[model samples]
Structure formats: structure tokens, C-alpha cells
Target: MLQTLHRVTILGPRLSFGSRPFSVSSILRANRAVVYTQTGDPSQVLTTVTYDALPSPAPDTLNIRFLLAPINPADINVVQGVYPAKPSLTSLVEGHEVFVGGNEGLAEVVQVGTGVSGLTSGDWVVMTKAQAGTWASSRNVRPQDVLRLPRADGLTEVHGATMTVNPPTAYNMLNDFVTLEKDEWVMQNGANSAVGQAVIQIAASRGLKTLNLVRQRPDLDDLTRKLKALGATKVLTYDDLADRALTKTIVKDWTAGKGIRLGLNCVSGKDTTAMARLLGDDAYLVSYGAMSKEPLSLPTSLFIFKNLTTAGFWQSRWYKTHTREDKENLMRTLVDLVSQGKLKEPEHEILSIGAEESDEAAGQKIRDIITKMSAGQYGKKVLLRFEGAQ
Candidate 1:
């Protein structure tokens, strides 16, 4: 059954569905999510999809209409049962039961659940934690799981939606663990990642320097210009670092001969070796990704003589461990950066959630594209859009 209710509030004009009206289990138009109940091998599409009426807004929950969810390599790993963190079969679609798979997403608040004091309908929000199906039409979730976004005047909603993941990964790597000296240089591989781009922006904003590295591409010169425009101190291809001595010289000059105080490696093994060697005495190296499919192999000298320390970070673990106040602060900082026009991400094509139900070919096409990225180059993260959100 379809029903409409008119409420008096100026969140723009609305002929809405599923979630805006507040009533007891009043079915409104909403997106039904598809999920994989079990792991899928390379040849199998072991996933089931459901589109049903959204449930009544949950007490202490914020009913969200998802906008955009980025498809990351980590998400693929989760689907294949390779990732360590797993989202529970937490959603109820009224008649049947199954598990849903999703991690991060952007959304809009359509209604506030009972006793919810911090947010309301029409506000833009993001998943306070992971597993937000930015791929669904509507989600009724705990208020604590929602991060309310201010009306950032300068940024588009698309940029705001995409901001939560990589940007913060880059920011915390620099801000949380070490004190970056002004104009001092840090070295990192994976310089073209969305997080890498954010690192360039945040590092430049703070007057710290970066030696950015990436594999050579056909448009090497153009990519270099783009990174430089975002304040990359230097951009180099892996070909230039075939010799470790050359790598050291390039890094030392970038750091004004103070030697690099830190090395950031997302690729593993020898690619890690190039960065690890550049750290000055007592400097640190941190790894958060493994693009090269190799483990981080370090020599004994760098650890003892150079006094380099190594560690790793995952945003999910960090969120769970931090006090509520700290989580809010990091979010507020990222939002403020967007508001000031200092942080810029690519504009995304919308993938409304309703598209999932009527179009099997379309959904399959998206899933295929998401599964094929490690072999090619992409300019920005592919954000799969969910429709009818908020």
C-alpha cells in the first residue's frame, strides 16, 4: 500500500515515500537492499536482493535514506569473507530475514526515532561507524551511529558524502601519531589514492611537506601537475627509485637534507623497502594498506641503527576505541575542512537505490565494475549510489 502525508517544514518540496511520515509500521516508499548470505567465489554471484517497505522508524534510531556508498577494495574483501570485521544481519525487512553487506555510506535523515535528541528530519548525516548501506533507500539506525553534517556552504553534497573515509585515514596518520615539523618532509607511496590526495591537501594546509610516489601512468605529466597543484612537495614514479641510493637522494633533497622523519607505505615488500630506508634516526614508518600483495619485509638495520618504529591503523578499530568526544572531534574537523573549500573530492554520478530493484542488468554491471579495479587505474573512488534516500 502507498500512502502520503503532508507535514509543514521547509526541507524543500517533497512528494516522498517510505520514511518521512511518522506512524506505527506505516509502510512508506523505501529502498530494499540486496545482500550475500554466504561467501562468493570468483565465478558465483552468491547474493540475494530484497525490496520491501521500510519498517517504522526505530526508537532511538534515525531513519536514513542512503545517498552514495563508495566501493573500496576492503568492501570486496568483506563480501568474500576475507575481511576481519563483519556487519551483522541487523536489518529487518518485516517478513523475511537475511544478512546485508555494506560498510560506509552517505545519507539523509527523513525522520527521528523516539527519544532522539541530537538530530531531526532533513539533515544530512553519515554513518558514525562502518556498515552503512549507502546503497539502500532507507535505514533506521541508532542515533549514535549517525554523524550530523552542517550545511557546508561551499561543498557539494556529493563531496560531503564521499569525505568520511580516505580523508580521515590520511589526516589521522599525520595528526595522531607524530608531531610534523613545519616544512619538514614525509614520504608516502600510493600518492594517487583519494586518501593520498587528501594527505596532500591537509599536509599543505599545515605547511608540512610530502614526497608522493605512484606507479608510472600514460598521463604521468598531467597527474604530476595535479598533485603539485594540491601542494605535493614532489611527485615521482617507481621507475625513478629502482636504485635505493637514488631514492635516498630524492627523499633527502625533498626534506631539505634533514632526512625524512617518517615514511608511509601502502604497498608492501620492496616498495616498502624504498620508503623505509629514508627515515632519519628515531623516525617512524606506518603502513595501512597492502596494494602490492606482498608482506612488509624490513631489514634489521633500519629498526636498530636508524631507530625507525613501525605500526598500522584501521579506522574501524580506532572508532570503537576512542571516547565519543574524540570521534565527534575528528568528524567536525573533516567537515570544517569541507566547509572552508580546502578539501576537494571528485563529483559523483548518483546510483539511486530504486535502480537496484527494477534493473538487474544495471546492478550487475556496477558489481562487475567494482570487482575489477585492482588491475586498472581509476581517477577517483567509485561511489555506488542508492536511491530514494532521505
Candidate 2:
């Protein structure tokens, strides 16, 4: 169970900036952050801390209210202390120190600072910094810390919240490793994942073809139809790849003997090696995740004889290495694709924490969802919406 602090209301003089009037006290609203004192099982260590109110932002800072945050697999890994990147510890809850739990979110600027420029209140933004403690009702941030969404009119909060991770990973993996030409075939496993879906749509938009593979599920027919609807050239279960003769036959027929030159892998192990066997000479296999928790073992004969290249990609590292302009360009491109209907919002379910709900209730609700997610029950994304964010 979690603890909640008593709410306090204060009326103070309003400040004026140009034609916009900003109230200092109105911005000083209560805040609740999902935090953990130590890293371990998320359901066991996670709790909510309610603070009376947040202080006004300093110069060059803006106060923001989170609209939506996502519970990504990486976030879980971070909470479990298995990930390389660790969040900075904070004393936001008065005397107690804890770490906030979220990596990606969409927020609205509620109050603009005196020193900030170009952005005003009501603007939508996404964090550029990794592990910025997004699982909170409200927080103050700097302009450089976030990227403003160029077009938010037609996009939903889900799109904005998820824009930073999966979509970019999909896009970058496709473009960075290989110089794929139109009508070229690309192979990938875990094709039903968010990144996989983005790859399908983006490939279709550019006249490229994708051979998507997923684990055999009870709803195979339904999932195949869904992926094809998103522009996937072909969808098959991992079971289909088990038969070497059948896989060879299918690959030959699809590529007309040209052979697949690029493969995207998230599920590593025997299945990935089986998928890699289909790649042509000088082909590239990019691994972004190891969801199967198995080591990627490939035959050295493929590398020696076919000149195959294996590599890894991490989007967080990309953000850290690239310039701000580069990030802005990538984001603008993704936003345009969404606006043009070339990309679609991910299928998701919202887990809302009501404004008047008790802190214990909220914490338990989140833990329940995390438990379900850990058990592989949620096939779609789970988004967090704190009603008290306003």
C-alpha cells in the first residue's frame, strides 16, 4: 500500500507575460509519482507518493502535466535492475528518496517560464532525455529536455507517448544498416511487436516488402490478417520456419531467387538462426532485442561463405550520440508519416488512475497490470493516464 499527503490550496497573485496571464498558485497543484526505493520486481517495489504541490519552475524551465505514459519492456528491465541505464535517485517525496519509473510519455506545458522562448502553455511535447521520470502527474523540465510535437492536431495521445521508442527503432534499423531498394525483400521475427508493426507500415510506404514472422498463437489467422492490413507482405508463424525445405521453398518463391538481403531480429536463438539462413550474400542481420532470453548463435559457415554481417542497435544510444537537429529531423519525418496516414497508432489499452482514488488503490492497480504484463497476458500496449495530471 502507498501513502497520500493532505492537499493544500493557496491563492496568490497572478503574473503577466505579454498577453498571457500565468497564476503561480494555480500551477502549484498536488502531484503523485510512481516511485521505487530499490530496484527489483516492479510489482513488489513500486508505490505511489503524493506530494502537496510542486514549486514554480525556475528560469528557462516549464511546468508540464503528463497526458500519457507507456509501460515498455525496457522500463520493466530498468525496474528489475537488469538494464544498463539507471535512473537518477531523487528526493522529490520530502524526506524519502526514490527513483521514478517511466522512460517515455506525452505531456502538455501548463506554465511557461520567464526565460523560455518559442514554446507557450498548451504545447504538446515528448521527453528527449532518457529516464526523465515520466510516471508522475506533473513535473518541471527545461526546453532542451523535451521536443515539441510539430503536429499534434490529428495524432492521439498514444501516438505522442509512443513516438520516441519503437517507431524510431523500426525506422532506423531499416534505413541505417542497408541501402534497400524499392521492391526489395526484408525478413524479421517478432513481427507483431510495436517496432515490427512500424517496420511493416514504413516498408510498405517506401515500396519495400517485409517477411514478418511471429510466435504461433491461437489467433494466428486473426494476427496474420491484422499484419497484412498494415502492409506486411507476408506473415507466418515460427513453426513454419522449422521445416527447412518449406522455408527455402517459400523464400525462393517470394524473392524469385534474389534472396533476402536484410533481416530484423528481436527474438534471438534457434529461430533467429533459422531466419538468418535465408539471407543472401553480403546480407545484414540487425538484432535490437533478445526477447527469448537466448543467446544468438549463428553458423560461421554463413559468414565465411556468404559474407553475412551481424550487428546490434539500441535507440537510446542513438539519441545520446546524435545532435538535437538530427533528432528533430527524425521526429518531423515520423510526424509527417502519421499525418499522411502512412503510419497508424499502435493498438493499446489505457489504465487510468482517477483523481480521487486512494494512493494504495492506484499502486495496487498498477501492480496488477504489471503482473499481467509480466505473465505475457497483454498482447497490446498498456498506457498510463493519471486523472490528477490536470
Candidate 3:
């Protein structure tokens, strides 16, 4: 379960700065952001910076105030200097340069440039791609860098904050890979993951079935019940999949004479081999993540006899190749599922940074959350909320 945070918007005084004294606009909005100058461990490198005033939007930009931002595992990876995509360093911080440390988040258009079109004040939007520096109070960005989202579509701020990554990844993998028909099956490990949960619900919405696999746990029964309710056709522990007879029996019954044609693997090692063995002839296995930190070991028999085609999926690369319109359509579809109650938001915890709090307080809070996340101590996804302004 997730507790909701109450939002507090602090407005600044209106002023006129340009040639025309008649021009009235809000000036000198205070800002706070979590930034890192050099890539290293998050707790060591991340710093909280403050701005007494944010500049108004430029002719081709929009002033976006972040409503919420998620602390994803990939975010920690990028900060630790492991991820491929790197944020640009800036000297705007006065004495030294810094790089903002967030990728996915939801924001509101506080101000739009005179030349901007299709977006206005109060409209909600999200970054179209990664490395947009979302962990802040506000930013001035180009209209094309973000995609507008429908507030009336019925998604909460938490859901919107996370919209750019996990759900979209699951949605694309399901559609981009093997064409699965109604009642057809798709198998995946990390069944309890955010992406896995989204895959289960989306598959159900399309009348597809899923065989979900997870590691054994004390509350396995409860976890199984929960995932089943989320539309998983089968929720099995890794031990269950490891049992040869049990694996054959489950796959035989679920496939109904047609073996699983699509396999999504996040955990590699033996888990990858087990899934590869279950794929039918001409099946496709897509590896999006390596949660196990072990190299994938494929048996020679799978490719020679099963004719399985192995590939990889990365949402960032997909965004780079796809167009803006394509991204919008995907977001609208995913949000509609939430609006219609076909898909459920995952469990999450919110970390609020109040205006009265010092920069060290904010940085310490983020550090604690990231430390727990890295240690796998939290079950709920963690999101950050800034106070003082809408």
C-alpha cells in the first residue's frame, strides 16, 4: 500500500522585467534540485542545490515544474557510472559544474514560451526520452523534448511520474516481439517486477495469458495470489521451473499443444536456460535485463532444434528510433488502461522534500531511499515530491 502526499504550492510575487512595464509575470521562483557533478555512488556524489529564482521560459522553451520523480534502479546505475546514457555537466551552478540526477518524472507546464504550441500552463507532461534531468523543482525545456499527458485520463501523479519507463517497456516488448494472439501464452521471469506486473495486466487486456516465474519466498502463496489477481495465468517459483517433470507438465498444459512462442527474460543464468527450453519452434526470446548478474548460458540444442531467436530490448534505444507521435499514442494507450481499471498501479512510497527543509535534509532523504533500493530492502517503488510550488 502507498500513502498519498498532500501538495503545497508556494506562489511568488508578480513582476515585470522586460522593456514593457505593463508586462505582468511571476518572477523569482525558488528552486531545489538533486544533482551530481561526477558519476559515482549516489550517496557520495549526489548534492542538493538551491536556486532563489528560476528564469522564465525562453522563446522556444517551457518552464516545467516537476510534480514527482521516481528513483528507479537504472537511475542509481547512471549515477554510479555504470549506465550507458550520461547527463551533460553544466557550469550554471556558479562556482562549479553539476549534472542533474534523474531520468523519468511527471511535470506541469508552469510557463510556456510565446512560440510554443499545443501546450499551455497547467498542462501535464513527461520527458519523451531519458537523461532529461527531472529531479528538480522546475526546468526550462523545449516542447519536443516532452509528451503531453491527459489529466482527465484518470492516472495519479505517482503513475504519471513513472509512465516513461517500465510500463512502456512492457507494452513495447509485447507488441514489438512475436505477434501473440488471444489466449496465446508469453512466459517471463521477474513476474513480481513492475514491468512484469504491467505485462500481465496488458496481456490480460488483450486476451493473452502469461506464465510468471519468481524466486522462492516465505510469502510465496500470497505473492502467487496477488499476481494471479493481476491476471497471471500461472505464478511459479524458480524452483518450480527447475523441476524437469513439473516444468514439462505446466508448459504442456498451459500451451495446449502449442509451446510458449514468446519468452521475456530479466533473470539470466539457469533461469534463462529453463525459459529457452520451453520455447516452441521458431519462438523468440527477448532479454531486456540481467537481474541475476550472471551471463546467459544457452544450450546448443535450443537453437539447433527449437530454432529459438534470441534478441535484446532497450526502451531508451526504442525511443531514439521512434517518432514523437508514436510515443504519444503509446502513452495514451497505457494511461487509458489505468483509466478503464484494466491495469493497476504498482506499490510505491513517496519521499516529500518541503521548502522549509535544508538542502542537506533533501539529499540525506534521497540517499537513504537509494541505499535501501540498492540493497533490495524496499518492496514499493520510491517517488520524490517537492514542496513549496506547484
Candidate 2 per-residue lDDT, tens place, 38-68, comes to 7888888887656646677888999999999
Alpha-carbon error at 71 in model 1, in Å? 1.4
Expressed as tens digits, the lDDT of each residue in 150-228 for candidate 1 is 7766766667677667787888999876788898887889988877888888898888888898999899999999899
CA lDDT scores, all candidates in order = 0.69, 0.86, 0.83
Candidate 2 CA-lDDT value: 0.86
TM-score of each: 0.87, 0.92, 0.91
Off by over 4 Å in 1: 1-30, 46-50, 347-349, 352-359, 374-377, 388-390
Off by over 4 Å in 2: 1-29
What's the TM for model 1?
0.87
lDDT of 3 by residue, 1-390 (tens): 322221222122111111212111211133777877677778777767665455788898989999999988999999999998888875434445568878999999999988999999999999985788888888888999999997655688988998889999999999997898999999999999999999999999999999999999999999999999999998877887668787888789878878788999999998888777888888999999999999999988888988989999999998999998899899889889989888777788889887766566677888888998999998888888888753
Cα TM-score of candidate 2: 0.92
RMSD of each: 7.4, 7.1, 7.6
Candidate closest to the true structure, highest TM-score: 2
How many backbone clashes are present in model 3? 1
Count of backbone clashes, every candidate in sequence: 11, 0, 1
